[model samples]
Target: MTDFETLGAFYLGKRYDMPSRARRDDYVLYDAKDLTTHAVIIGMTGSGKTGLGVGLLEEALIDKVPVIAVDPKGDLGNLALRFPALGASDFRPWVDPQQATNAGMTADQFAAQQADLWKNGLAGWGQDGARIQRYHDAADITIYTPGSTAGRPLSLLKAFDAPPAAVRDDAEALQERVNATTTSLLALLGIDADPISSREHILVANLLHHAWREGRSLDLAGLIGGIQSPPFTTVGVMPLDTVFPPKDRMTLAMQLNNLLAAPGFQTWMQGEPLDTATLLYDPNGKPRGSVISIAHLNDAERMFFMTLLLSDILAWVRTQPGTGSLRAILYIDELFGYMPPVTNPPSKVLLLTLLKQARAFGLGVVLATQNPVDLDYRGLSNTGTWFIGRLQTERDKMRVMEGLEGVSGGQPFDKGAMEQTIAGLGKRVFLLHSVHEPAPITFETRWTLSYLAGPMTREQIRSVTALAPAPAPTAALASAPALSTAATGGGFASLDARAAVAPVLPPDVPQYFLPPTRDGALLYNPVVLGLADVSFANAKLGVTEQRRVILMSSVDDGPIALEWDAAERVELEPSALEQRPHDGAAFGALPPVATKARNY
Candidate 1:
């Protein structure tokens, strides 16, 4: 019998109640206390990485841990729609997991178990009927008869407060001109308003925060006018109202932007809020559930939201009382465009730092990337847990293998077997390894939530909040805001600076850091840091008690007569004989780490 088994768990539309005969490919138990070190999930496209990431979070939230799922692809909004019906189903016949043997379980037994799980309403996981609202318009589409040729489009603009509709369809002119105009407008707007840039996000945030401060409502044009020039304007595309149709759609969007621009009406939210934890919790007396930044904005706007929140979240966390206790997790899916700009490596570095020590402060980060090459060697090495799934390329598999110390750093490395096994692993069965556990356990992720996550369409994203017209600037764009850290006022900017701080030493340095890595990879092997000297000749023949010097003792000890020789420097780990702290460690105990399981 396997030491770890769970046969009675329910699954999609079925249930199972095996009696402690759970197969090796079910799920691995992670002692929550051990999770403080943090984790990583790496796999190729369609390998169920996203599903697995959500599963862990589903469990964690039940465990009462706050979490942040960064959906650069804008899929996490489903969480808002993840209702109780998720995973709660009993409508189908029970069946055993794939290919159970008679001893494993007869078909009848499998059916019983399946029935049991489904009957318990522990069916699949997550909200089975979770919804992904493509666009606000899609959800609340109000049909408007072209009121007239001169002004129907213009009237629509008034509804959304879009710039007075300039394009006019002539009953006399060629139809081609009218069609071309509409096409140009849609193409320019990119059909949907997702993928916003870092700049645009801040603009929205800043506008809201600023308006919120003024205590008065200002519409889109009013806000845009405020940010018309230079730096702030350069961050993202300025023309948001074109899609909103100031005249055609509805005025509520325009009114809401101003209200959001105004501090009081805009949910009383201020600044960009992103971080592994706070995104999960409502801060400053706010609701802690979720913020569905409707994907109605353009790509630049969408990207802006991602970057601003990330930067802001880091800033917010710093405001928390202390280090070594951040308990938050970030779920990043389809993580590419949102990574640090291709020109900047620091962005990757910034994310890795967040992963390394999130545990101390009670933070956990999960990255689900389709492109395996994006996983960094240094970052992945620091993760406490790793879920690696199937891959298409030998090179990508090799990249993952490099994360294994035995294979990458010239220590009895086995590239072929590891690579072959990983490259061929079945779908949804991930190779799970973590700092707290040595053996690379394989399991099908516990299905805790319905898989409603899918790519977004351009039209679907535009329906949420439409862009508000920029307010014409009557005064210098608000003063450049100075961000103060938590020690002072608790704002998002301050938290970011602190989160971005890098460690000063390496993991094996024997220094006490929540996460051992400070900045770059440690250049030394740690095993030697605590070794005691055992040279027989160094025993001194017990002559030390008598204070007598032997001929051999002086061979190298005498400063006056011995000839000096130089030896080539071989890399050696620091040891107790030399590495002991002048002032000993406060705790005087080894750091928490998982023991290596000797066998697979």
Candidate 2:
């Protein structure tokens, strides 16, 4: 027989008899591909929920799958507690001394006992130190703490970046993203503004829509400026001033500006930006298990960060090729508040979008929660797999059953029978319900390779991730690839402060100045700009196409200057160019070689 623990098959555990309370010999191998349709884990406290979720992630990582887990409670950081030696010393630092005292043993003795218990638990589940090592070597686990430097900080600086062409081209997706972003931003400012009623919400939404539609990115500064002086003069046929006067607009701007100028707000702008590809893979292209711990963030911050992340993931998903096999997993540890039933939060919109569309692109979403009452079951009606663990109350069981029935999609479901099975479920026992399978089965979760040290402190988190790679500079990621200027000392030459006029170019070499978007004075620099209309025609293939491209390259007096090969392709129109610079704008001195038409 094929080994149940082989790649692509997650070895959850052996089957269990509920009525007889007997564990079966047959191992339950869950196919990783089944996750393409997504899954959910619903269990109450003390029901072994975290263990099962962590086990699933471990299996996925061992199979070379990348995971981006959002951990609100901080328990998932225990993924970093892998100790290949399985020694007492490895468990000493993390042992609970109170538990040791209760058990009538010294801390060292208790640690030794814990080590032995882990060894025996692994043996009982047919796992050993070798398998643990395999799990450790499979993927590098990193804990990321947003808005805090406890772990690797995750920056929201690039969160407002324009979506890729895929998302921008789809009107519904574009509007959905805009709505989520705007709502989340307002929420961070402690405004519970509704998209339909609140002028604040509508104006901010329109500002974002206008900028993003033009493929322009905005930081907090730019957004605040836009709020003060909107690009458009009207709001849905009404005059802008009448809708929101300049005084009111300035008030709104000040609020946002105060947030931007806050003492600790800079932390939100530091560290790595939210890039889905980087989060899913390491620099060497290996799969990674990235755990984003949000336990330190407030409710508003969590909603805002999650909304941005989901929006980015949605954009990333649209750029990926469609596939039936699972490409990656997005696991949200607690989904209660993010996706409530009656009220729609910014996170909910993106979550629903992902659940409906991400499956086609091989992105599986796993949502887990201990609170069943707050979930939006109607939104999760299509979830393909569910791991139902021991419930706390009859009400919780009823809510889960209703969700399960909705997921059944007209298939026969025996609520009473399932309830009995759930009632018979003991700790660590779960009912695995999957649409791909004919019927639900009961199974016990296998031993976890990593030690469950509970919610880790900031100090513990830092210790665990001390060896992980340092985060790359955000500037390096934001900037486009450019030629090395090492020979020129990697910086611009000293400028002529006396020069106040724009450099005159040959008639054949057209020059157009860019209009400034901000209120500050502008500075002009000479560059070699070219526009071309290229065409490709093939008679046999019956293909004919024409495209407009604009290339811009800096002019320098260096030996390898004016290289069109190193020019950046700019998405701009010739009409937007100005024939003259704005009044009072400063001019940067042109290089001596920039005036030559031959250089172009």
Candidate 3:
């Protein structure tokens, strides 16, 4: 028998006897490794589904197993609400003041009551503040909101980044990613395109496949340009223009461009890049439970982001060495439309792929849903465990039984007994069925360490993540070779005295000198330059503007590189940059800070 106290075994709950209506002393210890085959949770709204899911995540984090949770309903943000103190003060800030008024009690009194209730509930389940503290110490928890800044905003800018070598080398995997990415992008533009029939889909997929094959990356602008004039003359047997005419391609490009130019769409490109490695682990290599809250995004935006994320995750998984033990968990709070029966959305392809191949990489996927009928039973065949909670209708019960039987693999499945067990399930009770166990176990869910404050509002999320680190800075010259006077023991005296030739820079350092707007002898003074094109717009206020600023700063011998605070912003167009300096330019002496490309 597995010990419930072991790190690899998750202490879900004690076994329950439906006939006696009593809980047994023998605790149900679920081996974490069994999750390699994946799991599913199905129940009604009031059947404690969220509580069970949250508890499962809490256990995974406590065991130092990293988790990436996709939360469409916003409840997963509660993972950050764990309070080891379990005091009234710990619960006060999250309690609804209106609830206190409804109960004819003061806010403080309500908080105190809630705290006492949690304490008693945990004690009843053989848990306390000590276990909560252990969970807090085990992993770092963060809530990432994709299209909102209330929580940590996730940027999709890296979505167009080139795939790793492993994925690029595998033709099937490469094409799968290309297809999903193209389909998702089109879907975001309100276009439901068929991969084979739609000219728009074929053009985009060809562009992506061509670029990714050569290890080249394409931003939205580059992709738009490619759509106008493709790099390849032929997409297949026919010429590119014959397959997708210029005018038609331009129409597709304009729709995507409009979405890119939307005032609200900028938020999608702002914050941390959607990197699976960063989401699963912190910079220090510690496990982290990253809750991606996408409740704020629209259906199209959600599908786009989810498809890109899953594609990135699949790519990342391919790069990792194979492992048998569970290395990480990918939990989706809702698996409704993303993996439906008949429809083949962009997300469905990646989900099915993960379900089939991710086990070898030790990536366990756990999907939960209230609407079991919306799910595809073919995908469920890969799942090894099922947590069946209370259902509201007999039809739902029948569907769940059918799914269970389909994945049973010739095991003796008694449908009547299973249906009877599921019908008897009450609130907070679940029937645990796993291929690793000979018999399905009926168990009650334990108390969750997080307070179920319901779906959090934007303001609430902001309050929760107020102390997160600021966004990273944008520095272009950081990759340039460092040139310092300290190393050379002299300034650019030769160039300063000659005043006729440009100073020689390393071949790796890219130089783009602006064309002289005014008629004069050009004096090419060495200064670190930074440029940014910013767009400001508000539909409600009817304001829209685009501005470009060029900031130049003289480098010094100080420890810090170019001080942007002291930089001068000049009105200049970045488009006028030339490959070489003016012919008759006089070179100025470069500073120590200007020697390195990183200073810019």
User: Considering every candidate listed, which one attains the maximal lDDT?
Assistant: 2
lDDT of 2 at 351: 94
- In candidate 2, the residue pairs with backbone N, CA or C atoms under 3 Å apart (3 or more residues apart, or in different chains) clash, namely none
Q: Point to the candidate with the largest TM-score.
A: 2
How far residue 352's Cα lies from its native spot in candidate 3, in Å, is 0.9
TM-score of each: 0.43, 0.80, 0.80
lDDT of 3 at 521: 54
Per-residue lDDT value at 172 in model 2: 88
| TM-score of candidate 3 versus the correct structure, residues matched by position | 0.80
Arranged by TM-score, best first: 2, 3, 1
What are the per-residue Cα lDDT tens digits for candidate 2 across 432-493? 99999999999999999999989988988888778687765565466634221111111343
Q: What 10-residue stretch in candidate 3 is worst by lDDT? A: 482-491
| Tens digit of per-residue lDDT, candidate 1, span 1-600 | 222222221121111112332334333555555455666667777787766665565445544455565555555543322333322232112222343364487666655554444334333322222311211111111110111111001011111111111111222121222222222222223342222333333344344334433333233333333333211323335553443222322233233334333443232122221232334543332213232332334554444344434433443444455445335556666556444324332235346556654555555566677676665556555566667777778787766776775223333545666665575576676776655554455566555442333533333223211321122222222442332221101112222223111112212222312222233321111111122343333355653332222111011113323222221222233331332111111111111221111110
Q: After superposition, how far is residue 179 of candidate 2 from its true place, in Å?
A: 0.4
Error of 2 at 104 (Å): 3.2
